[model samples]
Target: MSRRRVKPSLYISVDIEADGPIPGPYSMISLGAAVAGRQDAGGFTPADPEEHTFYRELRPISAEFDEQALAVSGLDRDRLCREGADPAAALSEFTAWVGEVSTGAQPVVCGYPVAFDWMFLYWYLIRFTGGSPFGHSGCMDMKTLYAAKAGLPLRAVAKGTMPRHLLSRRPHTHHALDDAVEQAELFANLMAWEGPGA
Candidate 1:
């Protein structure tokens, strides 16, 4: 009697720079994603973070934006207003890119405390493209993953609190592509790690 083998989940590390708290009123100024790794029955394969990547800067949706939120990303709003990709077109390209890369695996968005990123990403993909490549709920929170693997309380999970070996060597820059690359390194480390019990 042979059992079927389940395919690994293709962990896609994503980072987004947004202006304001939410999506409708605010907007995602930039987006980035990299194929972090694939973890399955056999084990894990750490992808080259530089390969299989996507990045885009989009024009603001509404006039309303928080100064602080906009300042964090350090992107020139006026420049973007003059030369940014259309939101709908950018998202459409993103969706197609996901499908192309994830031929036989499930694409899972993996980010630190994924909720914030997901909120904007999902909203944009759904609103602009009319559908999300990741669907309605395929987000993996690295913070939560670490908490479970380390057997630590969720509240106790922070980058400073984690074991040095588990964290990414790269610093967290606000640039969406850089952050996504940093997160890809982190995801690869997490996928290859064997916790307390195997």
Candidate 2:
């Protein structure tokens, strides 16, 4: 008999702290992700009871740590070697874990400043896995979505004062997991006001 597969609806909130803005030339100092499973059709609602989250820290690949980024994140490179997993190993494990969590369901992967995070993650995934399931197609940028749904001007929204304030409220602390959780909270609030359709 064939084994029955579990189809869990999942959403992933991910964040990455890099040595600098550019990829290839730069490196991902760390990464954090929060995965939640949907309990019902409410669709990523705050009230949903069937949600689980996990966090992981990755060791830096290069010694060229950006002083400003490091100061904000407060992650010690020496300590990361002791506490965090290897970069390639961590990415492999994380991708497999996400696949397991998502299983038979199509998961929505979200990030606040997706352009930055996605670029690094995309590069890292393609570098190791040969390709990324998340390519530009599967990612969601909450800031852009919020601006559109709230009917706010792009300039005003981009400032993150009105519709995009949630992204700024938490600030970019540099810790990957903390930032991911912050994005998750912002997403929850946005979903509450705009409803699942938004």
Candidate 3:
């Protein structure tokens, strides 16, 4: 008798730079992602941050933006409006890339405090491409994972409070690609980590 086979989960670390807090009213100016790791029912293994990656900058969808948020990324909204790729084309390409890299596995988006990046990304993907590579629920938040795994309160969790060993050596630059790679590293570390003090 043949047994059923289950596909592994492909954890893609994603990061986004937006001009404002929310999507639609604002815009996701840039995006970056990397394959953090893969895990099946049996086991898990982390992937290199440099492999199977995607990055792009998109034209702003709205003129309104938060100057503070926009300042953090240092991306010129005017230049992006003129030079960035169309949101539809950019998101479509990203989804296509996700499709190609996640063959034989379910693509799951992973991010640090996914509350923000996932929000912008999912909205953009659905709004522009009519679908999301990561379904409505296919996301993992590293901060939440760490807090739960370490038996700590969500409010008490912060990069500073977490063990230094748990963090990526990479700095948290606001640049989408750089932060994505950093988040990918952190995801891998968290995946293999046993817990605090381990």
Local distance difference test, each candidate: 0.90, 0.67, 0.92
Off by over 4 Å in 2: 1-9, 36-51, 81-83, 158-160, 163-172, 195-198
State how far residue 160 of model 2 sits from its true place (Å).
5.5
- Model 1 C-alpha lDDT per residue in residues 39-147, reported as the tens digit of each score: 7887789999998999999999988889999999999888888898999999999999999888899888999979999999999998998888887998999989888
A best-first ranking of the candidates according to their TM-score comes to 3, 1, 2
lDDT of 3 by residue, 134-181 (tens): 789999999999998899999898989988987899989898889988
Error of 3 at 52 (Å): 1.4
Q: What ranking of all candidate models by lDDT puts the best one first?
A: 3, 1, 2
The TM-scores, one per candidate, come to: 0.94, 0.76, 0.96
Number of the top-ranking candidate, with lDDT as the measure: 3
Model 2 lDDT tens row, 98-149: 7776666666677876888888888888776676655546677877777777
**Residue 121 in model 3: shift from native, Å?**
0.8
- For model 3, the local distance difference test gives 0.92
Give the clashing pairs for model 1: none
Clashing pairs in 3: none
